[model samples]
Structure formats: structure tokens, C-alpha cells
Target: MKLNVAALLALSVPCFAQQDPNAVEAGRLVFRMSCAGCHGLHATGGRGGPDLTRGTYSTGDADKDLFSVISNGVPGTEMPSFRGALEDANISRLVAYVRSLSHAGAVPVKGDRTAGEKLFWGKGSCGQCHRVGMRGTAIGPDLTRAGKQRSLAYLRESVVAPDADLTPGYATIVVVTRDGAKITGVEKGFDNFSARLIDLSGRYYSFLKDDVKSMEREYRSVMPSNYGRMFSANDLDDLLAYLASLGGER
Candidate 1:
């Protein structure tokens, strides 16, 4: 079932983040007693729980959503409410503790982030397809928050095998115009009437379905699949590390 994220976002924000130092510690203790079973001992996530440290949430990530998810629980998922078990004040501390996990001071990386950024824009030509921040093209997935959402293993797999897994809303499109002009790129939007394609160079191409001689939807990803062979192992690791740190600092 889909969650009412709109309602979740409309809830009031919690204030535990402004509490005394003891409250954060108290929240940690509460987490161990109440949440660790499913979220994991360190809140790294396990089984049904998602990694709190990644800072990605399906429900909302605002302070209000954090408080609501715990106080009222989600409607369609295994996440349960703590309204009767714990007071609102305690839920605030839990929110504080959860937010602390994503701070750079808490989670550190082993690889060189600087080197990784260099490779991603330089030799990798990633910007040509994937957009990072306000720059790059939209022919591929946006990596601006990749570090905050995807795991290290998942990032590694994506680089090694571009077509191994495809994110939703980002399928490939091959268009053959009536004039015999062929174009291939990532599909952004389409219908029986017309289609939009963001080509490799970040150029946008729109054509009416009837005007094109033929249009084929390809399951293959537009991203190059030779990164595992392109970069040295260490370079690849650094690149992943850099990519992983994109949305983490703030």
C-alpha cells in the first residue's frame, strides 16, 4: 500500500533536536530497547528496516515525519506506533539520534573523495549521461544523492554492469525518424501521441509517435558498461567513495 506522505509531511515538526545533550543519549538507549530489533544494533538497518544512516526515507524525512512515523506508525507497513508506549518527548530524542547518524562526523569514508570526483567528471564522462547537482545531462540517473540512497555494493554493481538493474522512470528509447534520422537516448516521457528523449549530450529530442518511422523501447541502460575495466580497481573504489559522499555532508 502507498503511504500518505502528503499527510505525513503536513504533520507538526518535533523539537527534540533542540533538547539537552542527555536527550540524544536517552534516545540512543530508547532505540536499543525499542527499535534495535528490526533497525539493527547500530541503526545500520536489517531485514525489514532501512538504513537510517543513508538518510533516505520512503515516508518523509522531515522532523515532523520522523516524529509521526514513530508516534503513529505507517498505515500499510510493519512499522508500528509508539504513541502508547512512549511519550512525545521521547520520540523527539529518537529523531535527534536518527538524524545524527547521517552526519559526516559520524560516518567516515576510507576512499579518497577528491580523486573520485575527478574520475567521475574526467575519464568517466559520467556528466555526459548522468546529472550531478545542477550540471550534467539527464540521459541517465541523477547521482546527486546517490551516496545517500544507494549502498556501496549496489553502486559497484551499477558501474560494473550498467544494464544489470534499471531504475524506474529511466528506460532507454530508440527513435527512427521518417527522414531516416536515427536517434538513441534515455526516455523521459512518452505516450501513443509523442515521446521525449534526452540524448547522450544532454540534448532533448521530442517527436510525435506518428511522425517517426518507428520507435522502440530498449531495456538496456544508456550508461557505459565498461567502467569495471576502464578504471583501475583503486580508481573505481575512489570514484564510488566520492559518488557515495555527494549528499552526505549536509
Candidate 2:
């Protein structure tokens, strides 16, 4: 049996990355400027981005695959085409940097994971609004893969200051009807003329601006803001460890 050139190149991505330190460094700069905001400075995932150091990607894993995704971007995703923003050589360097990170280890979490799980379900009361795997409710963002999708720092800030970085579409929406009924929930849809929301009960509602007495989309999180004061520092670290461990094995 013989492997094709493309297969050989893919198999030796790590080797290619190691052979050229200058290119890798250049790529690192490019990644820092263009992708670090979403992917984290270390490519460990940040905000809503996926972890790139996991050695696996939702898109194809070849160098060419990475190049394509960066140049053209993934449809229906936050990823945007960089073809116009960067030159071809820069994209290649970026791919090399990403490949170099394939074997990088996940950041160590200092807290106790078991204790964190307890905090999540017990003291944290997070299960009421958030779902991890199939165990919790759906009122908040599904955290089944949060460990893989967010950075440790991001998670910490989220727990203590929920409004610091609002997850897209999770902003609180308040609507008042002409009859004096008030409705509040996360934003499902919004426009100059209409708004849509889903409450804690998972009920969906849509209303036109003219039909409703008033509608306000507060650019803030509905999650409690006093978690920093509610839990001790150790408790926060424990919870973060558990969260960082999610989807890590994949």
C-alpha cells in the first residue's frame, strides 16, 4: 500500500510545523491579530469559538482544509472569509501555526472537579437554567460542550459578571402589551418592526412593534450578577475546572 502526497503531507503536519520556526512565528502573529479574539490567544477557545488545539476540527483536518476554511470561511458560522483581509502566504503561515498547536496540551485547572459538579447542581443552582448533557434545563445556553467552546478566563468572568460578555441572542428582551401584561425572555428575533422571545418556560412569542405597547432589548444577561459574592474563590475555581473538563476528551 502506498500513501498519496496529500495523505503524506497531512500525516506529517507536525513535522512541517516544526521544520520552519520562522513561518510558525509569523503565523502566530497573524492568528493573534485575526483570530485571537474568538479563538483565544493560545487557541484554547474563547467566547463562542471552538478549541483549535484539540488536534481535531469540525471541518477537515488537512492543511488544505484549514486553508480553505480560513480563506473562504464556514457558511452560517461566525467565521468570516479572510481571503480579502490576508494574503495567500499569510494564510499558509496561519495554517502552519494552527497545525503546530494540534499537540498542545489543555490548560490545567487547579480546582477540584468533583466539588465543582456539586456546586453546579447544589449551591450554584445552575441546573435550573443551564443544561449539561441531558441533565439540566434549557432556559440558558446548553453547556454540554462549554468546556470545549470557552476559555477558563471567559468562564470565570461569566460566572461572576454575567453581563460582561453577553452570548449572542441571549440578551434579555422585555415587552409590554397594551393591556398591561409584561413579558420577558431571551431574544429569539429582533428587528425595527418586530421582536421574538422565548421565556424561562420555553414558551415562544412574537409581536410587532405596533401591536405591543413597548419593547426593550437590554444588552445584558438575565443570569444573576452576584455569583462572585455568592461563592468563595475556591468554589469558583472548582466549578471552572469541571466546566473546562467538558468535551475535553474529544
Candidate 3:
């Protein structure tokens, strides 16, 4: 499943001229239209997607692996197959653009990571919902590999405006049973026929729409949106530094 020698050459060349300049540009445009939502504008990752600019991927690092994942999508994940949506040539161009991103270095973060760690567990109370490296609750997205899976800009926005880009399954849900009992928790699953939720205490519940009086899915995040006001500028920088330091080579 190797790409042609020309494509492989383009990966090593600065201009990628061997693959044709037009193809690289086309791939950049295609990525912006199709892949940027999850992978970030710079292919650094967004909305829980893994960073592709790191020259490594969870799906495998071969050119064939990238092509296969794009064409066939990963099961049990948000990535969707583009086999029907894009032509083979377009997919190749995308690969070219993605490879180009590896030439760029990661942006440096500011603030003290130690201070940020303190804020995460103490002042921020972030551990109450978010988990990092086997600690904290599972109510929110795990930060165990946050450094590798999200862009710094995306992480900054998440702390101040969580609802701006909601994660797939962490939305808020409210349900009222037939007996007048109300339940509110993070949505675990939802469909036309059924809904599942997990409360703060890590309790899970499922209900059939027919059996419940009402079920409301709030397409916004359950994470607090007041961190911007709560933390000082330095504190925010410290937090970002700590987050950026997570999941890197130990």
C-alpha cells in the first residue's frame, strides 16, 4: 500500500514539487473544506481529534495508512470515510498537504506548568469532571493526552467558552420520568428511541423515549463557562502550559 515514488519524494522535499505544486495547493483547499473542522485549520487537531502535524498518527504512520484511514474512516470514532465524498486524486492531495504540516514546529506555550497543575486540582476544581493520567472523574473529556490531541488555541477556547465547540457525547441531557422525577446529567448516548446519561456521581441510566415523560438534549457543553472571569491572565497561561505539557514524551 505504498504511494508512488514521486509522492514519497514530495514528503521529503520542502516544496513538494515532485508531487506538483498545484496538487499540494489543491490538497490544502480540500483539507480546509473537509478536514479542518476536526483536525484544525493547521492540521494540529480540534474537538478531540488527534494532531496530524506531528508526523505520527494513532492509525499508523505509513502513507498507505493515511490513505486508508481517509478513504475508509476509523470505526467507533468520529472520523468518517470520504470514499464516496472525494475522488482518489483529491485524497492524495490531502495527504500531500498534511505531510507539509510536519515541516512546521509546535507553537510554544507560556506560564509555569507547576502553577497550572495546582490550579487544575485545586483552584480550578477541573479534576471534579476532567481526568488526566488516571486521576479525576470521567464526566468530561479525558486530558490524558490532551497535548497530543488538541491545538493550543482550541484548548484555550475550551476553558473560556466550552459550549462553542461541543464534544460528541458530553452534551447535557435532562429527562423527566412518568412519575414526575427529573434527572440531569451528561449525555452518554441518544437516539430517536432511547437516551443514556451519567450523573455527577458516575451513575449511569438509560430510558426509552416511550417510557419517559420527556427527554431534552442540550447540544451545549456541561463544562463551566466562567473560567475567563475566574482566573487571572497569568493563571490562564499557567493552565495552558500545564495542559500543553501533558501526554508528551516522558
Q: Which run of 10 residues does model 3 get worst, by summed lDDT?
A: 9-18
Model 3 stretches with alpha carbons more than 4 Å out:
1-37, 48-106, 248-250
| Candidate 3, 2-30: lDDT as tens digits | 23645543454432232565566767778
Scored by Cα lDDT, where does model 2 land?
0.82
* Model 2 spans with C-alpha error above 4 angstroms: 1-15, 41-45, 50-107, 248-250
Structure candidate 2, residue pairs in collision? none
Candidate 2 on 13-34: residue-level lDDT in tens? 3423445445577778889999
Candidate 3 lDDT score at position 167: 71
Cα deviation at 96, candidate 1, in Å, is: 13
For model 1, which pairs clash? none
List candidate 1 segments past 4 Å from native: 1-50, 53-108, 248-250
My TM-score estimates for the predictions, one after another, are 0.61, 0.72, 0.68
Pitting candidate 1 against candidate 3, the one with the higher lDDT is 3
lDDT, residue 74, model 2: 70
Q: Kindly list the per-residue Cα lDDT of model 1 for residues 1-250, writing each as its tens digit.
A: 3444445334454565544555566678789999988677788754445457766555678878888889998665557889989867778879888887877354445679899999988999888887788877766777776765555656777888878867666778889999898998888887778888888776899988888999887888888888899999899889988977776334
Residue 207 of model 1 has an lDDT of 89
